[model samples]
Target: MNEQGEDTGIVLTEAQKRARRSRSIAIAVSLVALVVLFYVMTLVKGPMMLVRPL
Candidate 1:
């Protein structure tokens, strides 16, 4: 709210919008990479753990 105590919405500039988009894409890619890493780890450990003792 401004000095008048009126509620105002956010407005993003062109550069700000682009930066936000870039950050969003980077976050999405990082999330996907992490998921893939977990899947690979499960595949690599799943069978061996079943046969091997704790």
Candidate 2:
């Protein structure tokens, strides 16, 4: 019984590690996308667009 419990714990840890890695990758991709979006917006609207306000 104890060995089975240990095996289960190990499996759970591995699964958790994969989930964490996936989440990190997703966050990184999102940040990159956000940066690209901002860059494009700046190019289309001009650099001073933010300073002028609505």
Candidate 3:
């Protein structure tokens, strides 16, 4: 038993584990994409991006 009173909290079922893993992977991918976007925005000169008022 854990301090929180959940004896099998760490023993997730296979399906649960797979779901969690996929969620984690998606989050990591999104973070990486955001970082790359930020880097490109900062590194690329203004002329490379087209801007128009909506």
Candidate 4:
């Protein structure tokens, strides 16, 4: 038995699932924001600049 009195392989609880979903949504939003920022920067200049070396 695990700490919750069940097997260690137990699936996530409702709250845990919700938390995971929220995290995923947050990640998606952050990615979208980054993409928008990149697009805006590229539009402001002649072309996208390399912020870091490849």
Candidate 5:
């Protein structure tokens, strides 16, 4: 493996970087929304959600 001036990967263009960042933020927002939804559902369901008939 030659270490001198080794090209690890192609440099991303400004447009590509912006697009990648936008996608990342969108995904993060989606995941956060899902988590909030589940939390809200748990609150709305109350303790009865944990109680099951044996």
Candidate 6:
């Protein structure tokens, strides 16, 4: 029992930390891949893709 008036004994294992890090890295890589794919698609589509109708 502490300031919160309860036993706040929560801890993460080494394997859990590693898993979290791996998941974070995977998400970052996925986002970067999506950005690259979008850029490539824009280039392949040409300027016509940017044309807006009024």
RMSD of every prediction: 4.1, 5.1, 4.5, 5.6, 4.0, 4.9
**Collision pairs in model 1:** none
- C-alpha lDDT values of all predictions: 0.90, 0.83, 0.85, 0.86, 0.90, 0.89
Which ten-residue region of model 5 has the weakest summed lDDT? Answer: 1-10
For candidate 6, the lDDT comes to 0.89
Better of 2 and 4 by lDDT: 4
For TM-score, the strongest prediction is: 5
List, in order, the clash count of every candidate structure. 0, 0, 0, 0, 0, 0
Error of 1 at 38 (Å): 0.2
Sum up the clashes in candidate 3.
0
lDDT of 2 by residue, 13-47 (tens): 78888999999999999999999999898999895
Per-residue lDDT of model 3, residues 26-52, tens digit only: 999999999999888867846555665
Q: What's the residue-level lDDT of 45 in candidate 2?
A: 87
Model 5 ranges with Cα > 4 A deviation: 1-4, 50-54
- Candidate 6 lDDT, 1-54, residue by residue in tens: 569798867666999999999999999999999999989988988896688668
Whose TM-score is higher: candidate 3's or candidate 4's? 4
What is the Å distance of residue 12 in model 3 from its true position? 0.8
Candidate 4 error regions (>4 Å): 1-9, 48-54
For model 3, what is the alpha-carbon lDDT of residue 3?
A: 72
- Candidate 4 local lDDT, 1-54, one digit each (tens): 877888777679999999999999999999999999988888876444656557
